[model samples]
Target: MQPDNSQPKTKPKIASSTTDPVDFDHAIGPDTSTPDGRREIRRATAASAMGNMTEWFDYGVYAVAVTYISFHFFPTEGGTLMALGTFALSFLVRPIGGLVWGPLGDKLGRKHVLALTIVMMSLSTFLIGVLPTFEQVGILAPVLLVLLRMVQGFSTGGEYGGAATFMAEYAPDKKRGFLGSFLEFGTLGGFALGTAVMLLLQVGLGDEAMMAWGWRVPFMLALPMGLIGWYLRNKLEDTPVFQELEERGEVQQHSSLASLIRGYWRPMLVMSGLVIALNVVNYTLLSYMPTYLEGQLELDPQASLMVILIGEVAMMAVIPFAGSLSDKVGRKPLWIGSLVGLFVLALPLFWLMGRSFPLAILGFAILGLLYIPQLATITATFPAMFPSHVRFAGFAVTYNVATAIFGGTAAIVNEGVIDASGFLLFPAVYMMAACLIGLLATRYMPETAGASLRGTAVPDAHDTGILADADA
Candidate 1:
């Protein structure tokens, strides 16, 4: 799973097409890139990781601390509804964020814009921590809260697409999956850090005290990220792949919507299924799991958090390994294997979470491992499915659109199903269906992990072999 020193280091040549340019040696850039463009990948991955971590960290903290904030911000009678509504509404804006951010990343450089976004997110988060309540200021309080969330939404929309595209461009021809997966690790790391901090506060200060003041701590913590994100991104250079597109005047400029319609639309459609399968399985198991276990399964909230915390720890270690292995063994096999395992395992393990603490922990650990497919490969592969001009637009819009539909609704839907069905098995059915759809998609689409980011989509067999050979 570690970078395979045993494999031949030859670079695979992509097919020639009007759209596809001839392979070029690494040209001069602020970052030192290797002959085949490996250094750019490393720098891109590092910078992108910082961006992704902060984006998810702020969002995760908001979700974890929402109940606490609702207690302070909304009317007592309607607080829960207002809280859930606020969270859902924030997600509703993500697609719009993707739309606005994508073409900009494609047009302007990713580094400058992403830095601006970090500053917006940090300020918004800090303001949330210090904001006044409706009890003191009336309905205006909730309105102001919603407004702040919109700004956060707009900022994150750009952060994700830009970061993902940035990493994809720099990834080495053979090692894209492993290297790009560091971005996923950053996401998981941020979420884990945020959730762990929330839970630590819950354990340290009980819910009563937490709702009173402790919840504000996590939101306020984001203020420091402004300095950190800006610092990390300061020395980074533009992605070489992107730089090439900029020089050639191939970067998309109209709108993310126009780019998606012109030539990049099909890849966006492909990613729709991809995101559905991914978000359904991931959110069902992660974001919804803690509440599901504590509420439905009648376990301790702290215990459920601890279980997921352990699972997240396992994920931190396995993601890079899985990405690296996909570089050698091929992405399709890993994708199919993980899905099949989850298909078989979902029902039984979810049931066990309702039965005992240890079983719940074990079940979640396996679920975390299953996510290595996404954590390691998607960043490298999905953007490679589009031309450099549309890669940002294609990858971000499709992902955010699908996520808007499925990911944001996960907690509400799963809780609703459990509320209605009285059976824990329904979520398992959802998982099975998602994994199946994902499995079928891989069989049809060729692997693109860590290959040239600007390759043509829908290639024939020989080109497919070229893509497979290019994967790291």
Candidate 2:
């Protein structure tokens, strides 16, 4: 079939709520203007954000405490590197988790999967706190630690995709970007909170006490956090979009895998490609910055945690502004600007980070600012790439696969690159490369700001059912 010339290139028209047979926003709770609506929105937002908080809190503690974990979990020689390696190990199974949980999310409902993931993550994280040390358990200690991390990775694979989908579907279209920012806020908030807790503990307890038992306290905190997230999620209704699909009898009976494979290859590739930059920046700054500061630059461990804590707090403040701005200008503009900014500034930031405390904080803060556009808008952007039926699976599989390969291994890869080449700032080079890939991917995506969650179907020759379901 020849391509139709009737469709608009830049802005694709999608089915609006008024014209659609079903109201996607119904049963999502009270109106946005009413008291009940405001309370429901707050509860829904917390439900979504807390899951992100739980996942990142564990990650933040692990990354910040890698040095201590290294001494206790692995051999003395290269123990830190091994600890970092263990950190990366958990991500290896994320794709598998995505495959299992993503389709289940699409098949069942986003709320149930989210509740399950929190439980899995919380149990694994809490168990790590009580695990025997290398001195006490011999080789079994590291083995058990790796096993627990694998479980964490598996659960997290499903957590983020579902959270983003649920939040976007529940939000008002005009304010999706603004409200979506809360999810990322929870992300940075969790990391900042975890880092702050560790920093205070380190300051008060001293290294010896922290290494002995203080670290376990933070890990143990995951139990209560996860329980709160689970309760919030259980109290909420399923997303308006998913509910609408079900009501309209448009919910797919086939597996999300089949639907994705049959029609969503391009979007899957594009989403994965964009994630390259987003996650490399995420893991690099959020996950690896402390390691780089303390291990490579030889900054004080407590000071390094403090720098990251401050940077994350700053990033959290700016994320909603960036997300709200994207709603006005377009998701593509912010993404393009940030990719270019990171490409240009990655090297300079690293250079400044090596200088002194003030410059290091300044450098990290700048990098975090540049990174905000991507992190802030991702929840608003990626879920819009696919139709409601396969949104969870499509986002989960592609995001986790790319994250597993690039994001999870960022620290290890940077360490190896610098080690082999004798260049300290190779991470800057890596970040730039990832940004370039993301830039290319973003250009191909339709401008989706304020677009319907169920996209506008173009009566064109190139219409693939699933892709058209996502609209432009």
Model 2 clash pairs are: 14-456, 455-471
> Which one is best on TM-score?
2
**Model 2, runs deviating above 4 Å:** 1-30, 256-259, 455-472
lDDT of 2 by residue, 182-203 (tens): 9999999889988998999999
**Candidate 1 CA-lDDT value:** 0.72
Candidate 2, after superposition: displacement of residue 300 in Å? 0.7
Predicted candidate 1 versus true structure: per-residue lDDT over 1-472, tens digit per residue: 1223344343342222344453434433333344434454555677788778877777677656655666777758646546756766666788888887777777887777777878887888788888887877988888888998888877777777778777766665566678878998998888788889999999899878887788888888887877687777777777776777676666655653763666656567767777778888877776767667766787876887788888988998889988888777667778788888888888888777777899889988988797778657777667777677666767777888888788777766776777778877788888888888887776666665434454333322233244444442
Residue 220 miss distance in model 1 (angstroms) = 1.0
> Each prediction's TM-score against the native?
0.87, 0.91
Model 1 misplacement above 4 A:
1-20, 25-43, 74-82, 255-259, 454-472
